[model samples]
Target: MARPIWTGVLSFGLVSIPVGLYTATSAHTLRFHQLQRGTSDRIRNRRVNERTGEEVELDDIVKGFDAGDAYVLVEPDELDEIAPGRSKALEINGFVDLDAIDPIFFDRTYYLGPKSKDYAKVYALLERALAKSNRAGVATFVMRGREYLVALKSEEGILTLHTLHWADEIRDPREEVPDLPGSRVSAGAKEMRMAEQLIDTLAMDWDPEEFHDTYRDKVADLIKAKQAGETVEKAEPAAEATNVIDLTEALRASVERARAKGKQSKGKQSKGEQSKGEERKQRTGEQSRQGKGGKQGRTGRRQGRKESGLSELTKAELYERASAAGIPGRSGMKRDELIKALEQAGRQAA
Candidate 1:
């Protein structure tokens, strides 16, 4: 079992609840070490004094504050004397509406669990109260000699602590972005109706699991192949974005494509359900046409069948189709390039 990184009492008003801070996130990407190219020696970094050109020992290192043109070296003992006691306490100042805090302000999250047996009731009470009120507690805590602003919120009956960025840390967008007064667009009545219909056809409940990190997965697969000493094929270059000159035509095509996709998804789901039912029926020794053997036979034929729409067409063929459909940048497309453009166009249409 993993242990809590910090332990402290969570205080708000007259209420005090002992809590433990546990990390809520971790990095999964594989890490590599630096080494000498020719030799099998591992490379390491060193802290060297610029003036003396000598290496400095870790014990001799001291924290320094640059004030104007001079560096004021702070002694280790002096820092320890003024340091806040290693208290893991989260002292909540006040409660704030969840929407009041911008998503950008959130840095890292941690699970705040009850530290002691006596604190369980109070911790549960606080968690339930925050859930009921839909408010997050703004708290301050000192960790590793640095003070941090934290937002304490309830998640699935458990309390969660999220570190927040300071106000000054968020840059002003106006300073970096240019103003474009004429870029604002007003949708036409017909366009608005078609757009709404498309949205309604594609609307579904939010499921985060439906999406995967395709790029990361592909990278991992490449690494695995390389490790196994397999020759990796070079990936084709991506197709450039198509320029659609006719907005009305593009919008109409997009709506039609979305409706088609919705129908296709429904059909696939129904077929899958039917297949499952058939599998269950075959278990009872019923010699039905919808048996496992029949399903496997159909799957075998489907596997051999070529894709009629985009899959069957070569890159050059796709490019020509896209060009004929009035897509821009079709003149400079190679076979691979055309395939991507056509796929994108088809997606936009569906």
Candidate 2:
């Protein structure tokens, strides 16, 4: 079992319960050691006195603050002595609606659990009350000789505390961001509609499992490739910025591309499908065919193409035909719906 980093009493109004704080998150970043070039020797860091040119022990070090022309030195024990509640208590000042706290203020999170089973009921009561009321307890606590502003809230039947940054700590984006667009600037009506359509077409439920740290995975692959004396494929260069003149065209193309990608993703989710490489090849062929008077070519093909073979074409390919035919709500349709809609449109055209 994981050990709690801090154990203390959490009090609110007249009620108090002993609690333990446990770290809630961890990073899986790869660690690298410093090494000399063309050598097996490792490089290490040391604490050395800058003026004396000699190494110093950690025990000899004291906290120092530069005040104008001199230094104010203080011992570690002195800092502990002055901390509120001597770093043993977390007192809730008040409760506020959970939505009242801005997301930017939230920092790290910690799981807060009852220290003893005897205090479980009190902990449960507080957690359930906060969840029911959609409120969070605002509190301050001292830990590791430092004070922290935190919010206590119930999450999935347990209490979780999140450290918050002070108001002064948050930087103003207006001052930090350079040459940001102002509210006065407006996009063209056509461009705005196309961009909004693209967003709607690409909308999906939030699933963290579907996302990952691709950079970290690439680093791991690089290490394995180097160990086996193999080279890894390089990533493609980033796309250039769109010109102002091409904004509307870019937005329209983006909407179509997003719709195509959404259909492709849906195809992948089905079982016993073609390999990704084969799927890409087929898509490339379809795109190439469409690029050369695609809408005109689809019209000629639709007249001769068998209706039953419509199922053979991927959802993305069917969507292209639907787009060329100007079928309504085609972007939101499934593969079967696209086939049915396309068949009806083809018959009408005939």
For candidate 1, the 10 contiguous residues with the lowest summed lDDT are 300-309
For all candidates in order, the CA lDDT equals 0.72, 0.81
Query: Which pairs of residues clash in candidate 1, taking residues 3 or more apart in a chain or in different chains?
Result: 257-349, 257-350, 258-350, 315-335
Per-residue error for 263 in candidate 2, Å, reads 1.8
Off by over 4 Å in 2: 84-86, 271-350
TM-score of 2: 0.76
TM per candidate comes to 0.71, 0.76
Record all residue pairs in model 2 with backbone atoms less than 3 Å apart, i.e. clashing.
none
Per-residue C-alpha lDDT of model 2 across residues 97-176, encoded as one tens digit per residue: 99999999999999999999999999999999999999999999889878899999999999999999999999999999
- What number of backbone clashes does candidate 1 have, counting pairs of residues 3 or more apart or in separate chains? 4
Instruction: Candidate 2: count the clashes.
Output: 0
Residue 44 C-alpha lDDT in model 1: 84
lDDT of 1 by residue, 274-345 (tens): 543343333233322324556765553233222224457654445535644456766545455665665455
TM-score of 1: 0.71
